[model samples]
Target: MTNDHAETPPSGLRIPAEPVPLSEVARFDHETDVLVVGFGCAGAAAAREAAAAGADVLVLERFSGPGGSTAQSGGEVYLGGGTRVQKACGFDDTPEDMYAYLHAALGPHVDEEKLRLYCEGGVEHFEWFRACGVPFQESLYGEPGWMAPTKDGLMWLGENAWPYDTLARPVPRGHRPPVEGFAGGLLMERLAAAATAAGARAHTDTRASALVVDASGRVAGVVARRFGEEVHYRARKGVVLTTGGFVDDEEMVSHHAPLLSGHGKVSDGGDDGSGIRMACALGAATRRMASVEAALIVMPEAACRGMLVNALGQRFINEDVYPGLFSHAALHQPAPWWVILDEEGFAAYSARNPTAMPPDHVAETLAELEEELGIPAGALETTVTTYNRHAALGEDALFHKNPKWLRELKAPFAAIDPRVLARLAENRREATGISGFTLGGLHTTVDGEVLHVTGRPIPGLYAAGRASAGIHGDGYVSGTSIGDGTFFGRRAGRAAAG
Candidate 1:
């Protein structure tokens, strides 16, 4: 099983971004009706769906096993429109309501058709997860963070708390697996098991080096490297790229997502832009390549009780919005961000996490604290006075923070800088720090067919998950990644099988 046209370059054998001509292949080591690259959540779902659709499916994984960034996540699937879990939790949701909220929050260029389809198919997708043996409890955990405090199945993982709550009927859509800790590993394990039970064969430690194309420029197969040997696997139907994002690729990050460069990445190290590069070599179009999901992990509940101020000591965003939104806003503000908290707010935050780092600056009075933080004279005082005036009236006149967490800041104020840059200066990784992944990739159709820059679907080529920029546009909802991956992965597999 050798490709005479394939040559090891000076950099050694690597996944070629360019495609290989099928006429040069003397033999194929394996053959399948649908070939899936990268055995993460998307790959597993694709393989399962293709095999169940009566197609022979083969999955290639670069790692020793499955579970890419999906396993590193909190395992919350964003599902709405009156799912069984939602109904059991005594919450009413409709596809229209979900669509409206997503349309408003997803972006300046939201995918209307994909959003509508995702909302309409939410219930069916929930059922599919159940069929795959992914468990969901009926309980609801009303917490601030993405993951549920308990093994509860539902929570708010989007901008469903403050200003966005007024956009549509807010409903908890983050569906978590029934596990006490982070359920991402459990979720992927169940999905992979289901895929295996459905008769999908997976070849682990097999890195797809190049895509093979016929004379007509249609994708026909893949050339992979396994144990230092090159193997060609032919796909009679199509090839689906399910490899994760480009967050781990420094060069790619610096070129496209410069904001995320030098920041901590929330990836499984397999997201090296290989899949995206391979597709781009074939002239595949991309979307939102600059969009990223950066998380400023200051205790959200505690932040809601206090306030986030920039270097000039001015509030920019409502404290009660989703953390992802909060982080997005924080990144664009002036440097040296700080979370200002009073005694009560600090106590509440400390109770949530006892091991948190001490406050960066503390003072008995507002002016003293302002001086200690080296804020512009009278800036902190003016901001606090205005905030207290509105907070006392149970109203936020500026940013419109939720009234429930609003309170006047009195004497004895403290400030904590949660920026990763601040922590890195001290050579520490602890405390709340910025960590994120790239949210942009190849552009594809609803059926997961990769599209060209000219807006035509590439024959015999498909993609899903982070490999293809799907639902996310400008902003990200916590569970949407896993949700988008599994949902569209099934569609890609079924489409390729046909």
Candidate 2:
């Protein structure tokens, strides 16, 4: 169960703030130009930018170090929409193209102008990271990445209205820093170092149990359980909620995203839907509930354990095509897919380099699937034969699998890990991704304002990252999340400094 891929809150989780006298009702522990709540990429960027802008910045993280889900990411920044990174990667993209792509991808569930501004800012933000000492090596030469398309396939041909991020024409636009090891992890290390160097004070090993609402109903600060004791920290400027999405909160997932395995455990206890629940308590209007989902990874450890069956009791898609979409395929098959793999498949996945070989390359027989997936003897035997037979010929003469994505294969279930689990159809739906979220918390303007339940912006408040909505739309390309974190973090920092 233990390996590099297993989820562990990134190191450096215990951050300390000097204690105050017990007599004081509130400690007002410290103050900053920008008070960033949740020290993930978004929060860290906000703190770093604010501090770099000569404003005292305060950063609070529930875990030991930075990197909410970001710490666990593959480090592929999806910076599309005419970003300098995009142009440098040798692709022609524009804000208009970004807006069109998202609109086409999401159909009616998107805001165009907000998305355009986000794209326009995306390029600048990427440059800012490099400008600020976070080294990002460009990936201009690699295999074509998975891209989504309109049912009509118009996104790649050129100018099409309402194009989604998945429809994005594939390009080598991703960038990573030169960290000797863990190519994706280096980015997080650099950002954390930058935040600390910029004089941003971060408190780790702290849990924000509740949001403090003043007599004026403005969000004052947070009442936290730190070091196993109650502590209060007030934000003089604004409280930015970059706590991240609720992937591991089983109760919340069951209540909201039912189609998925609601019982999935978070990498850490940090993502407990604290921000979402806090806003809801104060009457923050939540828009899409069942709509938004996250990257569902089926690893050795997960809550749901069962046999995946297809409509005709067969396997579909190259389940091991890529780690990102593997969970989606698991959750959305016409029927549950039968998990099939062998010792060789398991060992191959254990290797650090899995992309070199397909999951199917691992040998698996019908009997093996019967033991692993628990399907009936005859039904599973036929399914395995059909899958192996059809998959080898490079044609889904039976399932109509997308030819571009299909290849003949052995057992893919073991390509990633020896274990398997159930997921939601939305988890695989190309339109849904971390970029597809509609973040709404303090509803701060581009300048960052803490908004009331009625949509009135609170003075002395601001926000950046997925903590605020309308920053990203349906079709999020790579690198934009970090772009927003850096760009808006700096902007919010400057605004707070003023």
Candidate 3:
């Protein structure tokens, strides 16, 4: 392969990263039965599946090693259809229950086929990860937070709290690998090793710049830049693109998901929208482009035991929903948010989370605290009075907050601004900020076949992971990304190998 034609754009290109024609290629540098682009959780799983299916799989990664955004995650895989771990933890979860919660929580645009398949196959998927050397313990971390604080294997990562709990039986479906803290790195380590062991060859620091299409408009291979030179790699069977999302691309984020522009990105800088653009050039359809996972983690979930109020000092959300759902609700509320806590509540939060942000304004009375927070004279007082009245009866009449978290607000109040805490954490390079990632990409079928704008599957081209939108529609659950990516990657790999 030569670099001379690499800089030239295909004629009448729809996007800057359009696919190249097979006729334009003078020679082929490499060939494989399946070409897996970007060695993230999805790519690793895809490579392993395709190679195990007796296909010559080759994985290309832009980074120095495996592990994309998956390595930066908390390593929680949402699985709950009566798996052994769930049984060991004394939780009876059925596929119907899992589907009910996910269908209700994932969105107004949920893909029923994909959701049904995922729910029904949850147990087998769990076993598959175990077969890949990913460890899971039977212990459960019963907490109301984002990631598990302990090495326990299970936690609730979604709206498995009050309101949703009423709809479906709540279960701890978020299964973490048995690692002390932030085990995403360990998860990817095992997955990458599994892929390589399955005979999938990987070339790191190789960037796939464009897709190659045959005369009939079928994807044939990829044109990549490696070692300061252009290389053409032909995929005799198919190509799978798993290059994550577009969160790291500021221009793409601002245009597609403007709401996520200012928030911190939870990526490793490889989610630049290049893979999406390349696929779109071949008439691939996209969905939920405005969808982004905005995490508003007000640490020491004990704060939910108090009250989350807006600038008007009015309670808006239940305060006990999943942190991501709470954050979405918070984003729609008035600016300058605060979690108002009484002395007892503040003391409890401090005792539990020593690193929790200190109260921004403390006063001996609710009236004094209201004044300090610049709320209207009687707004804060009236809100707290009403909340306390309902709370005294162990009931949240207005918001339907669970009785377990409802409590009366006494005197000596403290207000903590979560926005300030997020800013401070961002400055300190911590993951505590209001970080997020784009949740939308190329539209694909449950088999990972990319769909055309006319609802037809694009032959010889497939996508999984963030490069192609799967389970997530509007909101996000913490473990859904890794779970969806790995599960669908296998399906795509198998389909491509055939």
Q: Write the per-residue lDDT of candidate 3 for residues 1-498, one digit (tens) a residue.
A: 112222323433323577899999999899999999989999999999999999999998877789998998899998989989999999999999998888877776777788889999999999999999999999998877777768898887654666678778988899999886688998999999999999999987788888999999889999998766888999999999999999978788898988776777778756788789999889999988888887764763755768888889898878877777777666677766788888899888788777766788889888788789899888999999999899999999998887887888888888887667676657654333367898899899898999999999888999999998888778777788899999999999999999
lDDT of 1 by residue, 1-498 (tens): 112222333432345678889999999999999999988899999999999999999999877788888887789898999999999999999998887777776776777788789999999999999999999999898877756668999988654666668888989888999887599999999999999999999988788887888999899999888778899999999999999999878778899998777667788866887888888888899988988988875767767888988889999998888788888787788766788999888988788767667787889988898898889988988999999999999999998887888889887999887764446633566533677899889999999999989999989999999998888778887888899899999999999988
Q: Model 2, 1-498: lDDT tens per residue?
A: 012121233443322222222234445665555667777677777777778777777777766667776666545454555655455556777655555554553334654555566667656766666766666544343322222211111112112111123465433334555543233355667787888898988877676655666666666666666656666777665666666655455555566555544324323345555666665556554433443332433431111111224434565444322223344444565433333444444454335334333343232465554555445656656865675576577655554443433433344334222223222423433322222222333355566554566887654455565555534432333344555555666666667656
Go through the candidates in order and give each one's C-alpha lDDT: 0.85, 0.50, 0.84
Task: Evaluate model 1: give its TM-score.
Answer: 0.94
| lDDT, candidate 3, at 473 | 72
> Model 1, residue 55: what's the lDDT?
94
Q: What is residue 126's positional error in candidate 3, in angstroms? A: 0.8
Best model number under lDDT: 1
Higher-TM-score candidate among 2 and 3? 3
Poorest 10 consecutive residues by lDDT, candidate 2: 149-158
Residue pairs with backbone overlap in model 1: none
Q: Against the true structure, what is each candidate's TM-score?
A: 0.94, 0.67, 0.93
Off by over 4 Å in 1: 1-15, 354-357, 420-432
